[model samples]
Target: MSEARNTFGKTSITQKSKKLQPRVDLTAMVSVSFLLIVFFMLSSFLSRSNAMDFGMPDKRHIDCGTEPYCLGEDRLYTVLVGINKIVCYEGNRLDFSNETRSFKFNDNLLIKEMISKNQFLKNFYGDKKGLIVIIKPSKESNYGNLVDVLDEMAIVKVPTYAVVDITPEEEKLLADK
Candidate 1:
């Protein structure tokens, strides 16, 4: 609201002088400011990114003799993620005869197995980095199981690991369990 007042007592023609104070309406500006704040807050919260970092094998052929990072059969640790159980084995071959060990997703046995294998490698190779984990999630396994396995790898501080496609033989092994 603006008020008008007579600044001068009288004008030359006996007319009173008037002065009006300026008024500014800031209701729209304040509303827009609040709306913008809310919009930015929501956008920032929704746009936040969540991710996990892991190495992927190179597409090109890698020679074990030449490449220092090349994984050998003795250092290979394969994990098969199933619907209710996780099967793990050390070495390149997936031998169910005696090597394949199964553990439930909720149990810490898988973590123990990984740690033991990592320790075994560290002891045998006398190297700081040795274990190379390869995760194969079956179709029956959910995304959560895969995430859990990756988390276990992180927990164990495994030097190298990768998520790979499951082969038909491995899938059959999982189904037989």
Candidate 2:
């Protein structure tokens, strides 16, 4: 009886020694991670598409054609778009010295402030009937950033607009062209 019990225990030990290593299945995890990456990429693309695009008006628009816009009291507003600042002027000549820097439009607060200001400008100018807003952007500025500024201007309901202060002197000398 003892020998039979010993033989059974030895067989049990032999079976236990031939154990298989535990393996983790990474196939499902890899697939899920890949799907998540693809989803994020697609979502980013879609969000970019929703961003506003503002293109500079053609030179023809600035010409004023047959009937030129009148420059009168309460009729024209000048806007200056600098590298890191935006300021509004009451007339053609903007005073950078006494400039109201705090009220200037910035990338962070541009949209919110511009929308409210547009409503104000619309009513402000509508009281007088007609107005022209001129935009002056720096030469080194990015076109897209310029458009962002213009989009804000448009949101404020600025009717007639123009772009000036671009450096033709530098553009003509560019070797890349």
Candidate 3:
């Protein structure tokens, strides 16, 4: 709200028009501003994205009385994530001779490789649950790299995958490269 008012002054022979000061009431504006702020805050908070559900391996060891649970070497795949490059191999050991292959994040080579390997494993094992992927992220890698690898696993439709800590030997290998 706004208004103008005139004040009385001494009278003189020459008459002059007096200037009035304008007054504005801001109570309604303040209230509306606060309401808008609260509405936006609540809306943003309510619409926030939920965290992704990630499964972690259980630490407790299960005992098989007479039999040992073992996964075949060919079924296991290891992926090591570094700064901008990814190193992958089949089985637990990182063999530089012929098994290890490195890829960059910008390309689709890694995804294609994983899909082919997964398909091969499925056909060779004659079962849907044959491939097991183990992801090991190095210290130089960022969180986005890990998440990208996880996304790759999902894209490849891998049934079983675990995010494990990188071994010292593996770290040394990466450093030497």
Candidate 4:
């Protein structure tokens, strides 16, 4: 816009306002922002589910005719994976005769216990086949605990371990404790 002096030093006529383009170009900014968004979207890692190097037990040997599960009570060890704790015993049932041991989540006590048990069995029976383990996790047990217990089995080189449901008697035993 411009001002023109009319008569007595007074401004009267003026040019129309010119539309000046913005000096800062936002094209670079928009492109940079889009590139950043794309970078993050592509670089971010998606959470993938993982499992132990264990497979389903063979159905061939699960033929304890009358019983719901495999029998061989003497070789079977029961591990009850509870909330932040493991209640374990070496037998089919959590009974009076068999002693039970409980370990916390921290310090890897469960692993140690399993290792000791394995050593004991190896020394006593002089065979790895005798240590059959049945793992039962309560609803309170988390996925990590289950994985830890399974990992401990691998660490102890346990030949036979089965993840199973807790019987009513076993649940009652846990409730009592």
Best by lDDT: 1
Off by over 4 Å in 4: 1-51, 57-71, 127-130
Task: Give lDDT for model 3.
Answer: 0.82
Candidate 1 vs 4: which has more lDDT: 1
Task: Write model 2 residue lDDT over 82-154, tens digit each, in one string.
Answer: 5455555455543344333223344556456445555565687664444466666666556765676777666
Clashing pairs in 3: none
Off by over 4 Å in 2: 1-69, 95-131, 166-177
At residue 141, give the lDDT of candidate 1.
Answer: 94
Q: TM-scores of all models?
A: 0.66, 0.42, 0.64, 0.60
Error of 2 at 97 (Å): 10
Pitting candidate 2 against candidate 4, the one with the higher TM-score is 4
C-alpha positional error of residue 42 in candidate 2 after TM-score superposition, expressed in Å: 23
Q: What does candidate 4 score in Cα RMSD to the true structure?
A: 9.2
**What lDDT score goes with residue 126 in model 2?**
64
Candidate 4's TM-score reads 0.60
Mark the 10 consecutive residues where model 3 has the least summed lDDT: 61-70
Query: Which predicted model would earn the best TM-score?
Result: 1
